[model samples]
Target: MSDQKPSPLSIGDFATWEPVLRLLWAGSEVHHAGRPARVAGRIGRRSWSLNLRTRLPSPGRAAQVEDIREEVDAVKRVRGALADAGVDDVSFTAEIQPSGEAVLRLLGPSPAVEPGIGTPYPGALILVDGSLPEPWRRLPDPVAGAVPAPSADLKLLERRLREGLPDAVGATEEEITAAEARLGITLPAELKVLYRVTRARWEDYNDDHEAAGRESAAVGCELFDLDALYIADASSRHCRWEFAAMEAVDTPPDAAVQGLVGSPGWIAFGDTGGGDRLAVDLTPGPRGHIGQVIMLSHEESIGAALVADSLTDLVLGRPSTRSSSARGQRPPATAWVTTASLKNVQAAAHPGLEALSIGVWDSAPLSLAPFTGLPRLRTLTAYPGTLADPLEITELPGLEFLQLGPQEWRVLLDARAVPRSLSAAAIVVHGNQDPLPVVALANEILALWDRPRIVQTVLEGAVGPGPGAQPGADRRSGGTPQ
Candidate 1:
């Protein structure tokens, strides 16, 4: 299929180039891998479908049920992303076509009739009469003498990171500058250092030095290489074009359809091998942490997974990304992981202070004053407590959520001060406590909060016999279970 003219279409190119193709004519992905796979009947009203072959290396690969299933899974993920990206009804279908190539299908709005350029192929789009409308090659060149050199901080970081590499992974300032010009934007400062240091995966860095599958490195540092496309041509196609499409398909539910800013303005810079991406956020989310790194996973319930605000933080024990040294063992580097036992965290010397949660009896006192150094601490949840206190969490600078003993939180409501950063609080309300008191307290908490915040009561214990049953209660309706 690689040698075929017009060739078998790719799932990505079919989506991108077909819009350009629609300028001249209305077309749809009809079939693929020796069978009919039309999504017109199944697609939602606001969406379209693209059908083409799987982008596998070999021809007729989709004829195998395994390959077909792979493409189907890929399409489902892409559709879910589009839904989150605020693109309504952006779904797709695929099948093995009669020609033995997989056919990819996408269903969206009908293409507009505006004059357009660019073929489904790599080159610039052109008029039917052979006049150029858009480049078939790379983006237009940047004007001379206007491009900015790499920042000093970027250079210093690069120098510290570039140890042992003689040629510095073959990236040059000229290449990065050209890429910025083509994309019409400068990279974030740390990203500039990142690309300059290396564009290859750190795992693959020792491929040349591997002696019969053994691993070795000259440096003892725990830092891993970040993914970068330092070259202009790769960035334009992979970063600029393909990254936009990937983000569009994975738009967060809160974003607007017309003015969609995907996953809080994050752009893909590295891949996590599990279809998740590491990105640099251009538009800060409600957290107001700008230029921070985030993980975008189609599999994630909330699409954005906060990694770190900077690269240096990732390498240290602060906001460490998944590392062989830390992962699958004990306490994770940051607040991102969940563990069954707090003892494991203490044994690992990880503090487990950031976003800590534990099942503690209400009488047990949790002191925030002991961990005063952990400024990143944001959430604290303890349950089945007899009392709670706002003073326990008053000093946490980043505390956004607190769940503690009911008595403590109630007393906290009456306390002279509450943490300004405390945006949400959850507390256990024993059945013996009247609903009116806690309900009124919830209202007072909401009224006291200047911004939107949540106050929730987790009910426990039985009020004699339940309405429908004698013992436990249904979680949803708050009624007794049969």
Candidate 2:
């Protein structure tokens, strides 16, 4: 065996004409020696494309035209393969150089390609680079199937701090204060720094970054040492902080708590792990008080129970205290409910709730009457299914948004009912009852309302005339015109 290694090939190697000379010498068989080809260009903020080329056999002049046609078909196959692999925004164009030579260019981002090493006489070789172009920005949010973002509540932080600080030194407040007065020295600056930061604006830290910031602050100040005076100051500040013990108590299950006049409120519920249930309490005050309660319980049923219980405490004023943060304390009047079963719509537990979304656990008929009495209900959504009864949706004077899939569309059409209060609606039809009548019905409706924008007509067969029929024959009746 020869004691020599092959030279490495980069992406630029294939761009040259020398590769063509080498392949011609090796019986016109060219094999890709580098990564698969890709388009490395961008079109707009979130759009990108790739570039690729391949060689074709130099058959004699008689078959040269056929050879080019076959290569074009091969390029189409490649495009189809990329599309099947979930790649999008693709295009193809080719350039034929002098001397019966050709370059096929494919446009798209880093698309998927198979890996192999083989030689075919008078065949093309592809080279690819996987790097994205400059000015490429990160995706604003994680991909749908990727990991989820971290969620947290700041009120929980304050509550945990208040509960943990009192027992840190195991001494009475007077004793602690007397000792601090006699020491003639202020406690560590770190504790005071944290207390001030947490008190100033806890909402500023209310996100995935909260735990990270807290950890950094604690470690920087060396607060873990039991003998340190930092813990003493934190405890002292806790005893004096006005809202330190402002526990979020239960309220009536159906009480309308005012929120900021123009601010948006959101409510979400489902089984997110841990024993904690998420309850958002928005109360109206000088500004706004948005308190979130995390009730810990391993069972989902228990979590819902805790949410119901907390709402009762919050509404009844059983455990009431104002927050020192001037943002105010008020109950959220608008609640959006997402549940595993539509039956749990009542679990919203908010009286005079303004908005609602009911996500079904499975395909089942939904009854709109049960929810019709809602005084403030504005929006309602459910999975695709038949309606239990003929419902005049217009009865709900406040209804605004309604979404229905194919099955629900059939139900509404069969009942001969139209939603008069609907300002916006989406109707999805799965299959045609009969293509011709459906088309005619759509055309009739469009003509009646003089609204061409709402109807889209797609005809499947030939446009001009039927097979083996005269130009003016009536295809539907199989007869010549009168």
Candidate 3:
């Protein structure tokens, strides 16, 4: 309705997906002589999503199975189709008739969707353009009175670097200016001094491995060159919506670094050998110094740990006064509303809440009135039949991600009440259901966003009845067919 059209989803030729259907017909067990055998899978740019019965290799090489070499090759062939179609992922369902005919249906290339997590079904559907998770949208709080720490001495940092790497090449003023222009941020005084002492350029070392190692040791981390410096913003760190929606940002009063996904002022300067980043924090915490040093660990999703009070302390091998014990007082941002969890929506309703997952409920259905206008609430996932009324979803103004059962989505679709504020959405399927109808439902949701529809292709070919297992008979059992 907004006239916002998503990019085209190009459907590749039939030959592009044919080999996979052939492999599916050959690989799966045929359960009946009279009925068609069905097999379904999802394919992404890099990997294939195969079911447990498909029998691929396990981590321990323990699962019993047939040779999966051809299955892997077949998936690779379909990946080529994804590449050709210019989409990152797609899903398919194939039917092999007892009469040796086969039909393969390619489910998507929907620009609005992301690949589901370990499921044959699709993931979050991006309902709005350029929408990001709440945590990603949060900017660091400004500490107006913050000043450089006592240890932040640019002269001492340059002097220490000169003492250690006397033969190292430093960055020219023009090169530093060019880097600042490219990144659109001015380098801190201490950082500028460190770069001036040694640019950390490989060409400067004339391919000398020892020289690079010496520079790294002198800098107390693997220092990046002036040109390599970048702002560690939220856009720089990519996380899937399913996981990102569950995170919350909280900066403690005593923290030296702001608790954020990333910041425009957090200039990454080096790495701590084990894939962690060392950044100069211009957007410091409440009691923190303006140019404190923070380490962005690779393992965590949000926030940085104070590595040192300043870059001068880093080079001098001094520890930060801020301790990790001071940071765990924030309220829970994600809440689970279910029989086993919080018990009810009213119990989980809090101003700090960001995501709420409504699981299987044994009692009467619940209402959405408890969460009507909660400003920070962005994600909501309710199990099938748990909601008293699906139309209550319209009252949630800030919801960016919504996951409901197919029928709930249908209720919203028919009433034309699907929230326009949603950035992404999903249909939660509990039991075995036909994927065709589900794909159709997904298309309706995509249509609302003006996203390309999942192209359905019907291909017919001879696929002989798969080897010997009959309907109601387990081939491994020492019993007669029922």
Candidate 4:
């Protein structure tokens, strides 16, 4: 044996395994027990090695090891199958640990395999390790709650990550600055790092980008976690708070600021100027259930008011399970807008109204004439219940964003009337209607316009089972609205 000891490997060496494990678990019934699977290796090169360790349930050690070995053989067999099926340079190795768990390693040029290849076997533990590129490390953790059928479009992980920031943890300005001063280093760069990984989770749901502004104002110092000090500095635009993970503050492309500071991860900020920072903590509670909570704090005088306002806004924006009456009783409103409330407003005919989001209301036809006279009324979303010839949308010259329900589409199609100067329009057809009629109506609407930048036609089943079902049943059925 050589006298020199083996060089220690860096965390980057085992990067590929993370994505592979994510792919394996995507849409599968695997549970990640919170313990990170160990990985040791460099990816893509033959010399790179991989090791993964996981615990197996106690009952069947020998049989489990044999089954794991067969599973490894199955992966190798699948690689050969992919090659036979015209995929190239694909190879993998799998082995069972002494503890009756499985470890998988990709040996060469990574194969393009379907994300959900292995059939899920209950009670089997999975651990994957490899050396992958940095880009692979950034892949979002597979959706945690439940698994859907495998999709050929693996970019769904990317989509979820893009949608919003993950939960985060935050600290005050004085707390962070004191820590930095104690460390004898200026804290600008460190603060930026923490914001980048955890900012996206918040941004996806922010709707107006106001939360981003709030986050930047509050995160003023550096904090440490995962062996890295996440930096939050207001002065440096490059380090300005973002949702996506960042490697360095000086990286270019100003547009990336939104992604870096907003991506999902724990974040801490200093409240130097009395602004409150929001942080999400994803820690396990007593029974091993993962718990997430958001914390906000501001200075003594205005802090309480600011906290109340921010919390109210955040809570109201989220989808809630409580009834409107119950939710409205609280200090902040968290209930979905109701048709009765909307119609009541129209009946009252408030002169102050400029724009209305009528999409959520049940169909009740009201003439557009009253809205048209109001100089400021520029947007209307009406879902008139299953009735034809209720109102003429074209009468409103100032209308910009028009949302029509299935009944309205039928009326518009039958009348062969197309509105002029429409900036954007969305039409949703009911599930009860034959698909052919909806398709035909959509075709007719498309033909009426020339090069319209914003037009969408959706089928009812595609939107989810018609609202109003047993509690919790509705949750599983709804497809994302386009």
TM-score of 2: 0.28
Candidate 1 lDDT tens digits, 283-329: 54332234555565545322355666555443322452322111223
Candidate 2 whole-model C-alpha lDDT, 0 to 1: 0.30
Q: Which candidate is the best by TM-score?
A: 3
lDDT tens digits, residues 1-482, model 2? 88533323211122221222222222222223322221112111123222223345666534454654533443334334444444433322222222223332222222121111120100001111221111111111111222111122235433444453332222344544553465443432222222433332223334545553443333221122112222111111111011111111223323222211111221222222332323333232222223322222333111112232132232222333323232224434333333343355455535455444544434455456656667756544444454455364655567544544445545555665645443333332333222223223332222322332212111111111224432212112111100
Q: Comparing 1 and 4 by lDDT, which wins?
A: 1
Show where candidate 3 strays beyond 4 Å: 1-13, 31-34, 52-67, 324-330, 338-343, 360-366, 373-375, 464-482
In model 3, the clashing pairs are 127-423
Q: Determine the backbone clash count of candidate 4.
A: 51
Q: What's the candidate order when arranged by decreasing lDDT?
A: 3, 1, 4, 2
lDDT, candidate 2, at 399: 53
Q: TM-score of model 1 relative to the true fold?
A: 0.29
Best by lDDT: 3
Candidate 3 residue-wise lDDT at 273 = 92
- Tens digit of per-residue lDDT, candidate 4, span 387-478: 22435566666554445665686676677654654444445443323323333344345445532111121111111121342111211112
Weakest lDDT window of 10 consecutive positions for candidate 3: 473-482
- Candidate 2 off by > 4 Å: 1-285, 288-343, 349-351, 390-394, 428-482
TM-score of every model versus the real structure: 0.29, 0.28, 0.84, 0.29
